[model samples]
Target: MRWEFGSILPPEVKYNLCEPEILWFNKYSKCLANYMKSIGDNHGLNLTQDSKPPKSLYIEVRCLVDYGKFELDDGESILLKKNSQHLLPRAQCEPLIRQGILQHITQ
Candidate 1:
């Protein structure tokens, strides 16, 4: 009932959910375990025999260098800027941290 193309769109809003990071990690770990199980079953590889269980570790990190693009949980890609802090999965940023591109921040 309203066609206001000339009007500017309202600003995007964000809210704090207060969800604990550990809960999200647990859920994601389960998903990874399930996926590995399916893949092992399909290939008859017995992946669990030589591999440890999947883990999800969330860590606070600060980018030391500008990373080109990184995907968020929402599947959108964003640029990681130098000195910007972010809460991300350890698996995604561990290598970068080890390479001095990111630094783990203790809170």
Candidate 2:
């Protein structure tokens, strides 16, 4: 998986999920892998990042193929079949846009 240019998921949106980081589908997706790398470089925290925000933070991703309608840990499951396609909405990926888990956005 190589994250390139898509939409980066916000930490807040992902803050409550089980993996609660990056959600990737298909192990070889380059868009996300490269994005993760770039983010890692920016935050210092690899996708596997933890504790506080790094110069670059790392997170996990549910492959798009396996995402969208799955049962989240909140106790619900959704199914989109095997050929459906979806992308995480920009509004939903807002965490990366802000600079806080504690620091808040800098404006």
Q: Which prediction has the highest lDDT against the true structure?
A: 1
Predicted candidate 1 versus true structure: per-residue lDDT over 54-91, tens digit per residue: 35468888989988788865597767899898888765
Identify the runs in model 1 with alpha carbons over 4 angstroms from their true place.
1-56, 72-74
Best candidate (score: TM-score) = 1
Per-residue error (Å), model 2, residue 4: 20
C-alpha TM-scores of all predictions:
0.44, 0.19
Which lDDT values do the candidates have, in the order given? 0.61, 0.37
Rate residue 71 of model 2 by lDDT: 41
lDDT of 2 by residue, 1-107 (tens): 12332244445644554542344433334454566667633643235334344342222222323334544333655453434433333222234224221112222
In model 2, where is the ten-residue run with the lowest total lDDT?
98-107
